[model samples]
Target: MTVPKGKLIIIGGAVDMGSNISAQENILQPNYIKFFEQGILKRIITESAHHEASKVEVITTASQIPELVSTEYISAFNHLGVNHINILDIRTREDASNPEYLQRIRKADVVMFSGGDQLRLSAIFGGTEFLQILKQRYQKDNFVIAGTSAGAAAAATHMIYRGSSNEALIKGHVQITAGLGFIDSVFVDTHFVQRGRIGRLLYAVASNPGILGIGLGEDAGLLITEGSMMEAIGSGLIILVDGRNMVETNIYDVEIGAPVSIENLKVHVMSIYDKYDLLQHKLLIKKVVKVENGVFIKADK
Candidate 1:
């Protein structure tokens, strides 16, 4: 009964979406005065920044008020020509549970959730009207939804806000909040290998067995679609922990920060140029390779 939230574009954790870095310039599309088809988040932001037609929405309620409402962070939307930007600080507002936010959720062409508290973001829209509107907009292809860090982590059906990776992947209670659930059977963890979060994601995957775990490094993400396509993008690697056929010991007794003895937990990492077929549940030949660090093997021998 529950489907994916929408098409998703996740940027690896800790990206300075507010910085004036020149590299981010490439992500901006300054010109879109007319006809369009592509829906890259950056492209949409750039187009909206210069005009008022496109809507930019942000939901960051985890950190302190000042942090959640960082003007620098808000600039990410302003730069994209977003005439109207709403910060769904639902943590502070009980009204976020009301249907008013749904109206904004439906109108937004680019909905972005800022980085802060993944747990907060989840609690805000976990099972509310806002989530339904997000789903509706996704089905229409009239929007591009993206996130960074905490936001990125919650982009999948299953999400991990915080945890440690000391050893055995003990299944811990992950905060399953409201995210746009754009990636089905997929749980996401930001700052993957770099943060040693593979364990938490692995643990979450083990609990669901039917799902896949995605761990993204800083500035890296998996651009996914309900149509079953996944594109790895950004500066880091996207680690895939597949447990469809995993065999393991009793994960129930594992303690917080305790490790579980897991077996047959397969791992795969991909790059920005790579494409994966989710429906087929395998990497497309476009470029499959055994990888190390974050660099993958070249397709050509």
Candidate 2:
């Protein structure tokens, strides 16, 4: 089967929720305190075709405060001058099968999932026709799927539900479950740095070394194209934990709650504009300039 080249915008939360200012007033304001100042929203807008006419649907199923989440996105999209935005208030599995909701999913150019509990999303949408349609649309059309925090974490087949940053290296500290299965070979963890999730991500990699661990920092995100090529964007770092070269791991043998041991796991830290090739399991280095002793210098030969 030929796979479609759909786009995914995965964000680590804390994107402008700190705003005390009004959304309408902050439309063009570039102040640091304002929302959408982090360029992630703009990047999302640019990814959609015919920005002015594209229909964007916001799915608030993961959020406990669905109304608040929906309103924020609505305001942000409006500020970005995008018309035809809809909010899918799908709170239950029954709602997931609603024809009206299914039709909305059919016509949307971009479907965004808000941050909340990832479990809520899986429980509500699992095995539903709505989810099947969404997956079909993603696999066969020029569609875009965006998610933040929990939303981002649930985009993969194996999801991190409960994991402690403090005790992440312990054998039983990290808990993972099945997700929406959008991407199967990658395990995603959001609010990476802010929540001190590196240890947890490493533990996940140690246990399931076959997959890649993506630790997304707050206000940071990656724009994935053609399923496997990811370009980093936003203000923070994208930490990739690659275990393809791992030499040893004690996770399987260690008793539950015991500290786990791992060796030779590869780690990659990327900044804005960095790109990664998942198909080849390689980082694509870019030719750029460097600063040497207060002098700008070219790094590319």
Candidate 3:
């Protein structure tokens, strides 16, 4: 398989785009706005080929309130000194085929999908000319594709369309579907730690151990380069569920709605700056060094 030259950034939910908080609160607490602005969004701009000069296209097709999402993204990008930004308000399959929209996608250096219903993304853009062009650019050019929340969930080949967090461990609770296919053999779940979504992601991987499961915590993200090297980013944690070495699992024997049993499922927890090799299934930890009174202290191995 040919390696993709482009990059993919998948972020967890609840990225502060300055739209959630009131203007009064933002004025009073300036640091609150700076947190996300200086963090993930800044990283997105920096990863692009031209940085601030890159033309970014924000697709809000999955969102119910596309106008609001569009406004928030526009404001956020503008704050980061990105003037070349366009919001693609594609709601229907017909909209996905618009000549103008397709032309804009061709010119964009970076494409971002906002948080919403992942199903909408797959349903609307599937088998469309727009998706074809996007895939082609990602394969041939150094394009950047970024998504958060539902957008993140849909970036993989397999997606969890429906699954309640509380009863996720129950058999048949998690529903899997075909996604955008930007990444293969991986299932992504967002708002991981906050929502207690490990069970669902585990179920996903247990159903198919060949596929690696990634659980992204809120405000956390993975910067995937060449579709193999994944570098963790942001403030929260990243969970990797590897089921390749499973000793036993009764998932196939268990009936629907029954509690399944599994043994020896391997899991890895990662933090900011940590790296994971997707193709090799290896983990590379970053060493932490502390300074104390002009003395440098290395963390114990």
Per-residue lDDT of model 3, residues 187-258, tens digit only: 999989978999999998889998999999877899999989998877678999999998888999989999
How many clashes in each candidate? 16, 0, 0
- TM-score, per-candidate, Cα-based: 0.74, 0.89, 0.91
Q: What is the lDDT of residue 165 in candidate 3?
A: 94
Report the lDDT tens digits of candidate 2 across residue range 1-301. 3455678899887665334421221223322423253468778878886665789998888877777667778777787788788999988898889999999889898998888889998889888898898888888888889888888999999999997799999888799998988877899998798779999899988888999999998778899988888988776778999998999988889899899889999999876677898888878655448744432233322
> Which candidate has the top score in TM-score?
3
Model 1 agreement with the true structure over 220-266: per-residue lDDT tens digits: 76676664678775556788888888887567666664556677888
Displacement of the residue 30 alpha carbon in candidate 1, Å: 26
Error of 1 at 99 (Å): 6.5
Global CA lDDT computed for model 1: 0.62
